[model samples]
Target: MNITEVRVKLTEAKKNRLQAFCSITIDNDFVVRDLKIIEGYKGAFVAMPSRKLADKCPKCNSKNHLRSRFCNDCGAKLNDKRALGESGDESKGKFKLYADTAHPINSKCRDEIEQKVLAAYKEESEKAKQPGYKPPAMEVPDLDFDEDNTNS
Candidate 1:
């Protein structure tokens, strides 16, 4: 799939590791939004759109975020064991509370998307240094919003 366009929105805080957020249009038809550009220990990298992880509360069967001490709905104490490492490796860090919503299937595709997004992010970051530069609208346009005259 060919990437047609990439839009980047640089983050304001200079001290944070998060550098920017981006959206990409694929083949001028498919659009994906909310990709993050982070400054990791190695360098800037693109992270696919992801959502926070959650689990069902045993007491209420309500969805509560991972690492929660108590169920949001029932307020019952959660099992601490459930908060263990995501990969089940004892040596690994804390349980991941987030997972990627969309990601490339292979390293090749991942590299392509990451390269394109990071390039756009760099260009946008430079523009941000200009005196009158204003950030672009990061919000994805609502496709379902009716633009034509209505209530006729």
Candidate 2:
């Protein structure tokens, strides 16, 4: 899929590892948002949007985060180890805390995404250096809000 557009929001913090947040449009058809531009140990890299992994509480059957010590609803101690694996060993819970919402299937696709995202991030970073430059707002417009105070 061709990366048609990429918009980046550079982070204000200098020492932060999270450099920027980006949204990419693919072929003008599909749009993926919340992709992160992180400053890694080696260099900057693109991280796909991900959601925190959750496990169901055995007592109340309530969904709780993987790292949650106790269930939010029931207050029962979470069995994270069991969720990680069949084995009861707590030390063996090496499961990932988050899962990607959208990701490339192959290395080639990943490389292409990385290249485009990083390039856009670099461009945005340079733009930030310009005097009186402001990052573009990523928020959606409120459709329900009236321009004039109708209720008043």
Candidate 3:
């Protein structure tokens, strides 16, 4: 798949490991947003968009994140070991608290995406250093309601 466009938005927080947020357009038809550029120990890397994993509370059946100490909808205390495996040792059988929403199926595709995104990030970073530079808008198109239906 050809990545036709890439957009990078540099993060404002300097202390954070997160460097920027990016979006990629594939073949000028599909768009994937929320890809992150993070500073890892080895260097910068691309992280695909992901969502927090959650489970229902035993008492209220309300959903809460795996790391939550208490339920959000109900005031019941959540099980800290809910995310653990049968061994009850996270190191032995670690459970992922986040799952990728969109990712490359193979290493080649992943590398390609990483290279392109990192290059765009470097370019954007340089642009930010200029005297009068404005960051590109990375707003997602609103698909929930149509303009004609809003007034009705």
Candidate of highest lDDT = 3
Residue 32, model 2: lDDT of: 93
Which regions of candidate 1 fall more than 4 Å away from where they truly are?
Answer: 85-90, 140-152
lDDT value for candidate 2? 0.77
Q: What's the best-to-worst order under TM-score?
A: 3, 1, 2
For 41-138, candidate 1 gives per-residue lDDT tens digits of 67888877777678999888999877678999989999766757555564674456667778799989998998899889888988988999999987
Per-model root-mean-square deviation over C-alphas: 10.1, 10.5, 9.3
Model 1 poorest ten-residue lDDT run: 143-152
Between candidates 2 and 3, which one is better according to TM-score?
Answer: 3
lDDT of residue 109 for candidate 2: 93
Once model 3 is optimally superposed onto the true structure by TM-score, how far is the C-alpha of residue 74 displaced, in angstroms?
A: 1.2
What is the C-alpha lDDT profile of model 3 across 93-152, one tens digit per residue? 447777788999999999999999999999999999999999898763322211111100
User: Per-prediction TM-score, please?
Assistant: 0.83, 0.82, 0.88
Candidate lDDT (C-alpha), each: 0.76, 0.77, 0.80
Please provide, for model 2 over 1-152, each residue's C-alpha lDDT reduced to its tens digit, 9 standing for 90 to 100.
89999989887767767778789999999999988777776888888877777878888899997778899998998765655666656587345667788989899999999999999999998989999998999852222211111111
Candidate 3, pairs of clashing residues: none
